[model samples]
Target chain A: ATTRIFGQARFTCLILFYVLFYGTYLVSGALVFSALEAPIENQIRLDLIRAKQDFLVRHPDVLDDDLESLLDEVVRASNHGVSASRNVTGGPNWSFGQSLFFSSTVVTTIGYGHVTPLSQPGKLFCMIYALLGIPLTLVLLSALVERLLLPATALLRSLNAALGHLYRPFTIRLVHLTIIVTTFLVFFLVVPAGIFAYLEPEWDFLDSFYYCFISLTTVGLGDYIPGDSPGQPYRPFYKIATIFYLITGLTFLMLTLTVFYDIPQLNLSSVFSSIKLDED
Target chain B: ATTRIFGQARFTCLILFYVLFYGTYLVSGALVFSALEAPIENQIRLDLIRAKQDFLVRHPDVLDDDLESLLDEVVRASNHGVSASRNVTGGPNWSFGQSLFFSSTVVTTIGYGHVTPLSQPGKLFCMIYALLGIPLTLVLLSALVERLLLPATALLRSLNAALGHLYRPFTIRLVHLTIIVTTFLVFFLVVPAGIFAYLEPEWDFLDSFYYCFISLTTVGLGDYIPGDSPGQPYRPFYKIATIFYLITGLTFLMLTLTVFYDIPQLNLSSVFSSIKLDED
Candidate 1:
């Protein structure tokens, strides 16, 4: 009974500490992001406003309201991933290649959302598709990660045998985690970022790296899609290759996570679960 | 030896079947989404082009290249969440409230991408923030869900006791799951969607529900966001409320999954694990 009471107290403390930690992280993130992006956003807004003013000055006969409405239409179309620029020669957003990319993003929950379903029926279909596809993707990823763990475990065992007297188990596990994380970063992030940077005309190394990070993390802010630049060659093949890269990268991420969880000292949740708190 | 061989064979078949199933699903989804959305997308694209042409016709003195450049600028600004419309009175997209929303979305991996960080530093900070925040969020949600499961388990125990004589354990568990799922749907999806539909002038029930579904799934295609309507009153309050809704709804989702995985027969991963293939 005493242990249970103590466990409950510790649990509450742990929860409180985490909540505080999370809250601080969020507030700091909000402040940092706001500080970082607000100036740039304001600058862009001002530039656009000034451009609109300049256009009106140049074309005096163009009614303000008409231009506003035209701009609105253009903005709305752009929001739907339909470019108004005449130079844009890519097929429509819902073409087979883009649709396939959209479908893959949906199932994997990366959801870059550059091209979402606009029609009502399309939205209904998307919801239904995601309902089924998300779980299927999860199961498939888990199964693949399970398979990948065999080699990872083999590496760990070999390391353990070789260094049994030299280091602590925790140190050895940390080393194992570092090696796997480095491999994951190299193959899934750095190499992929380099490839994306080379392929995308507008994206530099940083932008490409950000895309890989955002995508593999499943944040997928959709600000920079791979093949959406105006007139890419072999768009379908590029999209398919990205789809494979995403799936493979996600599997490696899961593999890393599984390996991380295997080290008992590193698994914080297990520590929490070991505490025997009363149900009530 | 016979069992080992059979297990290996079954595992291979299982992997193959899953791969085939996922491939078919992706292909069908691509087809369906393409069929449903292509016409609408093309129509929108044509409409935008026609609007541009009409504008050019009205303002004969306006150079086509100049107008195109302006439109491009407008589209680029709009993609960054800045409206070119003079009537847009809302503060910049990176206000504390919206940044809070963005921070939450990033940590949760929802990543609406409606307003992403444009600066290089912001992007770097975003990645680092997400790296730390995602794990913190996962831990926090797991802790909260662990707490929530107490009542959920109690409910299951009572249901078992009530129906023990009349029904099998599986049936009782199914009933419990059904009740929980209904409650989740009602409280999180249904009620919140209704509120959103009522609050946002443009969103109907379907749009609101889609937003809820997409967000809760962390797909966050971000075609729709709450509190983004022009000149909305109390925007910050509304955004904070949405943050709370998302976090709570996510916790409930995790709770449902915990209850779901508790049922022995329903746990397919456990069955697979039990097959016990050789490590090699």
Candidate 2:
């Protein structure tokens, strides 16, 4: 009874700690993002204003209101992923290949939103598709992770056999986790990022790495989708490759997280939930 | 040994079935979206072209190429969520409130890319922020769900007692899940969507519902973010309200899923994994 009471107290403390930690993290992020991006945003806004003024100066016959209306149309169209500019290239956004990629992104919850469903039916269907697809994807990923854990378990067993006399179990498990993390970073993040950087015309190593990180985490801010550049060759194939890469990368990420959570001392979430479940 | 073999075969069959189902789902979605959206997309493309031609015809003294270049700049600026037009309203996208909304979305993994980081430092910081914040958000939600599940469990126990002589345990549990699901829809989906539709000037009921659904799923297609339309009153407060709504909605969603998976026979994913875990 005493231990249960102590456990409840600890749980309460942990929850309070987390709430404070999360608030601080979110506030600090907002402050940093506001500070770092606000200046650049202002600069971009000015540059745009200057560009419009230059256009007006260059074309003295064009009335300001006329140009403003045209710009309004252009902005409206662009917001829906339609480019009014002649310089813009690449096939339609709703082509089969692109739609396939879109479908994959939607079900996976990556949802780049570079091209969304404009039609009412499309939006309705999207909600329905996600309704079934999200759970299906979760089950598929979980089953795959279950299979993958076997080999990981075998690796741990081999490590235990070889290093039982040398190190403690927790230390050995830490080493095991380190190896998994290293392999995951190399294959999923670093190598794929290098390839993306090489293929994308504008992306540097950092941008590519950021894209990989954003994508695998499923944050998918959609600022830097691959294969969307103008006049790109084999756009469909490139998109398909990216879709495959995303799935594989996400699978490996789940595997790594599962392995990480297997270590009881390291799984902070389990620390919170385990006590409650035991109390039940 | 024979049962193990049978279990392996069943597992393989389940995997194959899911793979096929997922593939079919993706392909059909692609086809439907392509058919539904292609005509509208083509119409938009033509409209844009005709608009440009109309502008050129009206401003006969203006060079076509020069106007095209200006449009290119306009498109580029618009892609980064900046408006070159004087008619565009609302505050800058990177205001403190907007940044806080962005931060909340990122950690929750909703990641509405309506406003994203433009600077290299901003993008780098975003990646780092999401790295730590995602897990933190997960733990917080898990802890809250653990607390919420107590009342849910009590409800289930009451249902089981009342229906003990009348219905099977599964039926009682099913009733319990139905009540939970209806409550979730009313509070998180239907009511909140009504509120969003009432508040956002341009959004109809479907758009509002779609937005709520997309956001709660964390798919966050970014097509219809609220409080972003021009000249809105109390925009920051509205945005903060939306952030709170998303967090609460997501918590209830997790709670529903937990209650759903609690019923052993209803959980399809567990069927695939429980046998394997038992073999181990």
Candidate 3:
């Protein structure tokens, strides 16, 4: 009986370890795969769709080294111009500065979903890079979170003690949550949204906010990407400002959550873990 | 006094509302702008950097697409082989099916960021399309989150209350988070990662995970894309599978987090709001 129990325990431990590492990859990888094939785009289709869009929309006529080359793509029968755009950064001419920027984004986990790699070799390398990087990001955030814990816990406890008389545990938590969410919105979301609207070309209020929402979730769908906006003379400065904001914002978010979690009396993650979920 | 207070409140309310809508874009746009202009990717610089990568990597020569049109770009000062890489659908004319798929990725926010909009108009439209689509995505996620909440919350509460004696609130919450995260990974990441590795020709486990991480973050870096892995026969099935995974995975991630938050007893958005984090 003792041997059997030990064997079972060992098996469980092995499964748990496998799940811990491979499990993360599985979920994360699925997200990537699903995102990749989810909607099925053909390069040719993209060209035609853009062809129609070109006729309908009056886009800013910008002149640049990149645009100049892209124009030639349209002139050719190749779909690279509008639809079947080729991945240009790989080959014997991959850009490190670009890669640096790419690396920063990946480590930050603020992936913009733009300028994807085309080659199989490139894809393989990127995968290896991320495995190391994602954990690095987590470690960075954890350290930040640890620093934020004491004050946050004290604040939560004080708030709870003060408000406990007036409200239930659930309602008080809600109140505390409201405060956290609001703070994030005002500083991280609203102020930045305004800055972007003012700085980025042609962005109105709605567009700016949409950009922020997409970004913070780390979704990074790059439709309204900045610096692409014309008339912005301080382009690099604007870009750097964004980088600072993302790093700080994410840190703050993590910090804020850590503060909340520090309250031993007020924690809730386990509150949801026990029941069986109907994932099917 | 009331008027002044109300006016300020109204302004704050407006800003808050604006942020709820556009905050993501603001964060992503700034980073993208920064990355794009960081003295990165000048053709000369890139070639020098990638020379080793180019020589070291040995890719199977893909025989599917022709190299005829790229010669024209090569003839021009545009040294990058704009015409020769990764148009799996093939040819300049393009079919309606392919075009629709391309449009869908852009508009849907499943944006592989592989084949991007080349023309300024196309890029601009891409932005506008994402703006509209982003909210739609949020709404979809919100709805899904709401739907998934009932079971998730029940699971958390039961698990926590039962395991309450053994763990702290933090551990409980972590357990719940783990459960939901696991469910999300199994259905979205693991299975999809496996499928992507299978479909993406040369993608190994690490590469698959990287793609998932990169794509889901919305970096759309395009460094490593799917369906472009040379010589895949069933392009359409692969495309559809990729698209489905993105939609479901994204929705599930939101659900996991949202369900975590939906526990009225554990809410924390109120914390920052109470602090009047923007009082200054």
Candidate 4:
């Protein structure tokens, strides 16, 4: 009875902490985005309009017979191919903040851009390649979590054994989880975040931590992508580093999840019969 | 005890069915792609060499510009630019499949494949756009499932009520989920797939279902995007209808998830809270 009471209290506290964490980042990011919307919009709009005008002027007689003759010659030289652009399902012009938002959606796999993907090659690769990679990454992260959880689960079991007479299993597990999370933060979040800050040309320590937090959360807002930095040499190295950081960060996240998974009482996705699933 | 056995069987079946559905599509796509690879590569190589020789003869002085200037011009026309392609990631000479893959990545929001939104606008829009749409689709689907689940959940409850009083609440929920899923397939998959075949220009039933399945799963391999058929008119209607289909399909997915969510189960993500924090 005493242990059960303790377990309930621990669960409430953790839920409170998670709610607080999620609330802080989402609300703050929204506010920041709203604040900067105006300037970013202006910059993007100006560039886009200039490009559109230039395209139009350069191809002013685009519909004429002279263009037809040019098209025929180009087609003849290329052995008779047809044009494939401009039956596009276009929307209103997007702003800079909007573009960042779009990039985030794509990276996060939450693409809801009513706008269609134009161009044939662009459409085809988008399908199965992601299906292959996303699951691979998820499984790898889950595997790492399982590895990390070995020690934590052992510690949890020992704690349960030590306090068997006094405390409930639930209460013991909560303490174990808190300890594991702290360890993860120090090693995974704090340390690697520092290293990323060192490497990212544009981000300071604060910004790098922020980026790590956001990306690992699966938010994936693209305002701070690695390779886009101007004058950055070794673009591939920087890009590859970012990918490694993402995979690593995801592992720590799975570690947190494994702590949760340790409790048979809470697993929800356990569809396998040999495995007991808990309700998260 | 008998009820529990039945429930376990049901759960196993559901997981197996879902896995098989997804696995078959992916594995077959990969096999098809692998088989096509050699033939496609040869054809593409022949075309590429032909294009190169023809370009050399036609524009003999096209390479007269300095290398830096040429690179700069192409960079100016990257996909990140609003005027540039939205789905593609890289510069000129990218394969058709690469751009199609890019489109799938962007639209599905996997944003993997090591490439990313190049232009400022593309990035911003990617995030913001999903924010508005994904949740809306989720809400719609959850509502749909709620209607389907009520009777199903009640049926399980009544079945248990009639059976021995020895079974756990979890077993009842499992039976209910199975019924609901069957209903989902009949309505979401079979009926609508038949309708798509009838309405879409020149598409057979199998092709339509394949399209529906691919689009809903967000695999979007671009092998069969609608409205791309030559001589097709009223493209806007087709595009809009396709968009509606995506939104509606996504809603069903969310509805199924909500059922899972309501099961009060321990999903791995929430397993950490299995331990109550207070006693430790």
- Each model's DockQ score: 0.80, 0.77, 0.07, 0.07
Instruction: Please give each candidate's TM-score.
Output: 0.95, 0.95, 0.46, 0.44
Looking at candidate 2 chain A, the ten consecutive residues that score lowest on lDDT are A271-280
Model 4 — TM-score against the truth?
A: 0.44
Residue-wise C-alpha lDDT for candidate 4, range B137-194, written one tens digit per residue: 2333443444445455567668788753776778766666676667667777778779
lDDT tens per residue, model 2, B78-166: 98988876766888999989999999999999998999998889988998899889988998899988878868998998998889899
In order, what fnat does every candidate score?
0.82, 0.80, 0.09, 0.00
Candidate number that wins on lDDT, 2 or 3: 2
Candidate 3 Cα errors over 4 Å, as ranges: A1-100, A116-125, A255-272, A277-280, B1-236, B243-280
| Candidate numbers sorted by DockQ from highest down | 1, 2, 3, 4
* Pairwise lDDT winner, candidates 1 and 3: 1
**Candidate 3 similarity to native, TM-score:** 0.46
Per-residue lDDT tens digits of candidate 3, residues A97-125?
A: 23444555665666564434334444555
- TM-score of model number 4, chain B: 0.48
Q: Is candidate 2 or candidate 3 better by DockQ?
A: 2
Q: Which ten residues in a row have the lowest lDDT in candidate 2 chain B?
A: B271-280
User: Candidate 3 vs. truth: CA RMSD?
Assistant: 14.8
iRMS, all models: 1.1, 1.2, 13.6, 14.0
